[model samples]
Target: MSSDVAGIYARESPYLDRYVQVGIAQGRVISLSFPETPDEGAESEHDMLDRIESYLDGVEESFDDVQVALTVPTDQRQVLEAVREIPYGQDSSVAQIARVTPGLDDENDDDLRAIREALTENPAPILIPDHRIRDGPGSTPPAVVDKLRSIEGL
Candidate 1:
């Protein structure tokens, strides 16, 4: 995984005890990681990083235009696409996402668990915005989700 990655940059956000690390590849975001403690370094000068920090600061910014590269299986990718469709300042249940997901079998052996699994493994938390998904933890840390919800006034 490290070999395939081109570069990673870190930036601090007062919103949490962690700094956001944005992974880049071919000029697009490929991964996003939030660590408990930020490393000593310059904040990223990347446009996407700037946009996210601005949005967290209550700026009128929408990440909907930012592109992400999901290096996952087809079914998980489909689930992620549905997760991305969740509008800003809104929420949806996992069942709702599964209903819109074509590759998902919402009835077979209780497909909700599969859907939950996919969202839990999402690499791009804010970019994919898994926190928008309702009814449970939905991938990211619970505290982070709560913070995001508060940030969006949801």
Candidate 2:
């Protein structure tokens, strides 16, 4: 993808009680965060923001159509893709993800650690739905994960 950032958008989120910021590059979300304060002059017209609002409103919105730009190793990308397949309102364990991840031995300690590392390094939280992973929030803050889980009723 291009190194140029197309735009950065932010909007107040009711669920998190903070502003949700999204970074877009080449029509795909490159990053997501909950900043204490919204960036000055940041636009708030992206469709992703609209969908996020709908999701926070208790709607079972699907983020599958929302494209994301993840810059990580092949293994981590595979794990993140597997996590995306998890249905909304449901959760999965690390072992389950490792089992589904190709070339990863679920019973092996190193493989499991790799899975955990991938999760902990997840750059996009809500967009990738890391909170859907049971007992694993990756790098997402505990409060954000808890709020997201509450929103999904999990």
Global lDDT of each candidate: 0.77, 0.85
Error of 1 at 87 (Å): 0.6
Per-residue lDDT over 1-154 for candidate 2, one digit per residue giving the tens place of the 0 to 100 score: 2324488898998778888888988888888888879888888777788878898888997689878899999999999999988899999999999989999988999989998999988878887888988866487788888888898899
Per-residue lDDT of model 1, residues 50-93, tens digit only: 77888788775557777788888888889888888887888888
Clashing residue pairs found in predicted model 1: none
- Model 2 residue 57 CA deviation (Å) reads 1.0
- What's the distance in Å from true for residue 83, model 2? 0.4
- As a whole number from 0 to 100, the lDDT of residue 141 in candidate 2 is 80
Q: Which candidate ranks first by TM-score, i.e. highest?
A: 2
The reply for model 2, stretches above 4 Å from the true place, is 1-5
